[model samples]
Target: MHTPLAVEHGANLKQYNTFGLPSNAQALVRITSESDVRRVVDDPALGLAPKFILGGGSNLVLTQDVRACVLKVEVMGRRVLETRDDAWIIEVGAGESWHETVQWTLDNGLPGLENMALIPGTVGAAPVQNIGAYGIELKDRFESLDAVDLITGRSVTLHSQHCAFGYRDSIFKRHLAGKGVITRVRLRLPRPWQPVLGYLELERKIAETGITAPDARQIFDWVCGIRSVKLPDPAVIGNAGSFFKNPVVTPEQCRDIINRDPEIVHYPMPDGTFKLAAGWMIDACGWKGKSIGRAGVYEKQALVLVNRGGASGAEVVTLAKAIQESVYGRFGIRLEPEPVVV
Candidate 1:
């Protein structure tokens, strides 16, 4: 006989999200396996309730109490699934800590994931956000993923093509959002691993140390060091990293902004577009280190919004919207938030 599904009603959610915003889940369930997800889908009452799949909660801003059934993914495991002449395939459980998984790979001599070290959240949330840092995105090493359909309770596997990965986005954030729960992710680390050092920070690190040909471990350490100095620890001070995405604009638009503000930070994309630095723009607009209510913009980085001691989720949203308005008024460009506000 199957074990009874334990559900926590009116579960406190302040601890689940990185922002530490005050909120509660109407019903919460710890999902430890694919079967656990299927069980929730199969249950008459829970099956009928709207569902929300939660991972490490790093990429989220809970603006209100969740009325849906919250499935907290806690599944954990990691293994070298295959070692081929061309690549090494590593499969990781959805609930595995993303940063820990990166460290684990490096510890086991798998070098490709080092550039993405120190990223917050869970493995399952990685593909959903197509999380990237330094110069490597999750898609760069993606193989396939396993997920259970919320409606049908049937498990499915999807490859890169089906994922529709874009800049910090994937199918999970679009058509498949809230429709299924990712259970496991398989990463394909290409053989003869090469370091990705295209970011400006990495370049500076290379020049500073005169280590032009740094290895994967060095790149990893450099990324960790850079991020640690820039971002505030959520444990100490509640925050969701990078409140807004760097806005990508057409060449003409970029030039227009450049004409207005010569010192605007902008980078050329491979497709002839330009990605303007959102944080720089916010800082330019004088929003950095500013606060609205108890929510405040992080002094160290304008892209992050923090909860200043007992701040509510509504306050966080208010601050973000105010910053958005300020930026839009000045730049005529809307900054989209990186975090999922709900």
Candidate 2:
């Protein structure tokens, strides 16, 4: 007979979350495989209990100790499902480190995920937020994903259309949140890989390096180099990558803000919407390098909120709210937090 899965009660969660906030799970179980999840589902004690699925803990804000049973995803695998003249289909376990997975793809001669290198999180969590960097987003390369419903313990495969991807938003964050556990993710990398150098920083890299034609590895290295200098390392600083999403606004609203603050940084989206830089707004409001309690805005990037050692999730939330209030008062655009606050 297979050994029973162990549930750890009063599990410390500080080490699990990127923010390093002190919290505890009432009960925690490590789900290393699909069978582990099924075991939890079939168990009489846990079957009907509320659940919280955790991956890399890179994009979360735990405000308090978790009351529901926490299922920590640790499944792992990666392989090329199919190789065609048009494209390559690759599949990876949900718990695989996203950065590592990107590197693995490059090592295996897959080139599509280079622009998204150094993104912190697990493959499973990537789709939940439609994680993006440079000029590429997860939705851009997504093909399909396998997830198991908590209520029924039945597996379902979802395509890109079913994901309902939006800017830092997804169906997983809406209809599927806490209801399903993603098991695997598939990526479709088209043949004749084209580097996404449209982002300003990447263009500057091209100018600085004088390499007009760069390959996938070049773009991956560039992205990693840029992120290393720009974003704080979570291990050292304790932060959720980008605290706030770039708020999208109408053209008229953009014009109104631009007229008021001529120096504001903004980008025009293909949809005719304007995406105002949240970092610039926070910096404009004088929040950069500032702190409230043990939480503070990162000195290097105002978009990041860091734990100034021993910070609680509540302090971070307080600091975020203050920034939001200031930005709204000045620009009339409410900043939405990117990380899911629990």
Candidate 3:
């Protein structure tokens, strides 16, 4: 018989979440392997307790003390699983930093993830939100993943189709939310490496630098530089990146808004709906750099909501709600927050 790992009681979570919200978990266990999760599942005291799977805590807003047992994933490993003429399959542990994984792929000559550089969070959490940046989304490269069901202690492999990815959403955010813990993720980087450069920032980079034909490495560098300028470093300033998702509207609705504000920034999706820039709407409503109870909108980018200092999660949520209302009142489009508010 093996002894179960010791659980940390009253674990302070101030430094866990990127928003720097102050909160505590009643009990927390660090998960370093599949067996660690199984042990927790089979433990009599812990098996029945509700569990919360925490990755890098980059895309979260904790508004209250967590009553659930926190499973802080710390598993770490990365390797090329297989190489084919058409694609390269790589497996990464759940705890690997998303940004570090992107850079590693580039350093190892894997180019499919260049457009999504600098995204915060962990590899395990990527699929949950279907995180995207510049022009590429995690689903574009996601192959499959291994997850352990907390209740059954059974490990299962799920492919992209099973994940049911959507615009910044997946099963992990819906039906499977909090039901399982991801242990490993596999990404399929297609061969014949092609660069993604359709984003406005990348286009501007090309125009400014006069580099019409850039490589994957160049695109990666450009994404890193652009994000650094637009989004504040969580370490220096507390924030969950891109506090809100861009609103997508029908053509009729978009036409109506465009008639009212001709300068609105909008993009046409392949599905015919128009995606309106939430930041632009917030800025148009004059919310840039505004603060309410220690929570403020980023001066550089209104899409981001920041913690001035010693901000409570409740304050962040209140500020977010206020911004949502303002943007809705002005543009008649309700902005949805991107982070999972707890």
Cα lDDT, all candidates: 0.94, 0.94, 0.93
Model 1 Cα lDDT, one tens digit per residue, 1-342: 998999999999999999999999999999999999989998999999999999999999998899999999999999999999989999999999999999999999988999889989999999999999877899999999999999999999999999999999999999999999999999999998977888898999999999999988898899999999879999999998888999999999999999999999998998999999999999999988999888999999999899999999889988989888998999999999999989
lDDT-better candidate, 2 vs 3:
2
True lDDT of residue 76, candidate 3: 100
In model 1, where is the ten-residue run with the lowest total lDDT?
Answer: 192-201
- lDDT at position 287, candidate 3: 92
The lDDT-based order of candidates, best leading, equals 1, 2, 3
Candidate 2: residue 156 lDDT (0-100): 93
Task: Give me the displacement of residue 206 in model 3, in angstroms.
Answer: 0.7
TM-score per candidate, chains pooled: 0.99, 0.99, 0.99
- RMSD per candidate (Å) reads 0.7, 0.8, 0.8
What tens digits encode model 2's per-residue C-alpha lDDT throughout 91-175?
9999999999999999999999999999999999999999999878999999999999898888899999999999999999998
For candidate 2, the 10 contiguous residues with the lowest summed lDDT are 192-201
Question: How accurate locally is residue 92 in candidate 1, as Cα lDDT from 0 to 100?
Answer: 99
